[model samples]
Target: MMNWNMTMKRNKLTVLIPPTPDNVNASEWWPVKSDVNWIETVYSDNKPAPSKLQGVDVFIGTDFTYEMAKFADKLKAILIPAAGYERIIADALPNGAVVANASHHEAPIAEWVMMVAVALDHKLLQSHKTFVTGLWDHWPGRYGPYRELFNRTFGIIGFGAIGRRVAKLAKAYDMEVIASGRSNNHSQIAQSLGVKYCWGKQGMKEVLSRSDFLLVATPLIPSTLNLIDEQALASMKKTSYLINPARGNIVNEYALYQALKEKKIAGAAIDTWYKYPTEETDQPRPSTHPFWELDNIIMTPHHSGGTDGTRNRRAQTVAENIDRLTSGQPLINVIDF
Candidate 1:
């Protein structure tokens, strides 16, 4: 039997690639060396054992655990092919191993944010249903008043890559952009993006009170978990809209349902959810609350960042990072542990 703890040199590097979409030939974007050994695996919680993961030098997957990490003695780098790495524990990795995250998701997710914001603002679902059923001409009062995207205040809770992208798009629509973040000082970056930046509790209230459309783009962290609770929801203008393309738990699920049920806020565009399907065949309810029954909100199956452009861009980023790693160049998008 091979000694799992014994570190091995990469005469022929082993690259582990996860299953890609049917149409996407991953080789086109993530090209590898001729001598490299490739390992293919199904992405799931029931992963292969440490013995099976022995010689992995580069792992390109979304999920990793401490149990699996312990066996990766020869691992040089772990590359997350997706934007979010909240679940990844930095301390779990082997000594000297580096981790990097990819983000071509920003552009597509930003577009989704803007699309749903406009759709909800105009009450598109209600209007379309009313129009299709021929209720518009008969009952104009049934459909609520619509709003425009122009000259409105667009607020973002987290000012990361996705938030900045959303800000840029919002600015293109001539909307006033305001952002609040966990960072003590994002003033310069915010100002450069032509957005007013705020921080901490008091600043959050200021942004919430004035925003016409509020977006939650923060990552899931200890401090950010349930960041948008009842108090936060109450602080917002009753006429404002909420758009969440970030993690589901970032907002208090129950409070959001209560707020929407009572019409406290105008409406919301939610692309992320509290619950998700575990398998390809399994269909799970997104929430305990029947958000689907609500007319004021728009719900999507957490697919905001899923686009062909996004996939290709992400693949390119991963490929470039791999090249950078081989050339001993400082890698881009290195996660600050």
Candidate 2:
């Protein structure tokens, strides 16, 4: 848990950002190491010199709106500092610019999903609010006004690394875990982790209907965008809860808002952003963002996978990948595309 500033002193990393990290002074990233060239600021002005990039090994930037490929010829790899890289660098991303999704940022993100799942099953939002207002509550005296995970069904929509981790933790809660994803491979991992099979569209509907806790973990792609819209929400039990730590765009905000407003389902925990703060002017999110007015909707500032140790972990990964490329070794976690 050393400071990025102090740790960076011996290792200079040039970071180009239109916007920089919110914490710590911007100066900390520079002057890290004597031989380290890790010095960069958000490129808001003139373009970087295309001819002088021979020493740069790693590129950490917001997005390549700044003609990244020009500076990438000698770059070993382009590391998208942000977790969601699906929308970054669509056109020209220099040849052999091995892409790695920010896996280092996923731990806190998965923990957020777990927290929401636990909160929903225990009915924290509604019950805790009452405990404060002196609105002495009565739940028909149901033994489980707060449900227990002991024998409940937990369903995860994506079987990627994040979803797999979610399943492992859920099973430890004594819950039956099921996940659906790109293929049956998810179920194979689930089976090994003491989870059951639930794949494909129809199988997913059944999984949705059967789950006491449903998590929207799928990626936001052509086939998956708005995948859990009206019908998927309808397929879920009114008693069930939802947790989405995936891309906010993956779940249609309007559909979710409508479901909660109408009480079509229990409640939801949402992280990620359909819209993020853009531009250099530091403005607040537009008031029109749907979640602002929904009490049943718990909103997070995309801090799910954000932890104190995040930068160090990400930097370490970048450091390794850089070393590998310099040594002419194969890179790790390279996305085929």
Candidate 3:
């Protein structure tokens, strides 16, 4: 059993859960009304207004803008429900306040990456389409050039939680793993996971050239914007596949479209997009480019990490962290302080 230190500060702490749309019932996921103060406030639907942030000790949600930071005078911590907090300005946050984000997204997303990698390598979608078109009987060699994941090289960019999980899954399929990241402290962890640790641009190039399947799982920032541009794509193996489960902006949409359209690489599997629907009913397309017309690419609706298991784990982490904060203990998943 987990020892929950709920005996401290339960009465005085006021947790603020901002209002969301009908599709997202914040109350259903958050803690119900109890002796512990749980305050429900609506702020710009998605973003919390400055006026509403006053006197709040802890803020739970994603959309914390720089403008909102000015009003968070009493804020001690900001807890995000998911792993990505690039939207929140870390430096602008009030002094003494910590920024933390959560994710049980790594496991499910890693599984999805492996599944798509194998599917692309084996030409699963094209083969299935060939059968559907009634050409399998006539064409014996249509799917003859399929590849296997066994003994192949797998490369991962941004060796964080999600990237590390991908390395572990790739190893299970007898793959050689290599990864590049900003920090080199994880060399020991890489060794334990059977991953070759690399750093800097030259190391990134080495991984891209050698990998049969290259995955982009890095956080989106100013430096990572268009990280996989024309030059980077040109360096990859012509037979290799690209798998991006990270933010859409990390890979340039136009460059990716051109690469896949011209067969610069074998194919690509994209779960994130450059554009999204502003309103639920807007139904906007994922990209400006005609990527849907490509036969070699696999496109998903950014649901690689949306499993129930991931949701439960995320909720557990949030609940536990809230308890920890109330108990005057160190918080979990702190990204900035």
Q: Which scores better on lDDT, 2 or 3?
A: 3
Candidate numbers, best lDDT first, in rank order: 3, 1, 2
The count of backbone overlaps in candidate 1 is 0
The list of candidate 2 runs beyond 4 A from truth reads 1-36, 43-57, 70-76, 138-144, 279-283, 286-289
- Give the number of the best model, judged by TM-score: 1
Evaluate model 1: give its lDDT: 0.82
Best by lDDT: 3
lDDT of 2 by residue, 1-337 (tens): 4785665453444443233467754334321223334544444322344434445666655355335566565565666544556655556766665666457665677778888877766666767788688765725374335557888888888877787888878877888887776667665567788877777787788788998888887767668888888889998999888898888777777788889888898888878667666545665663245567776767777778777677666656655655555445687767555
TM-score of 3: 0.87
RMSD value for candidate 3: 4.2
Candidate 1 versus truth, CA RMSD in Å, comes to 4.5
User: Which ten-residue region of model 3 has the weakest summed lDDT?
Assistant: 1-10
Candidate 2's displacement at residue 271, Å, is 0.7
Q: Which 10 consecutive positions of candidate 2 have the poorest summed lDDT?
A: 27-36
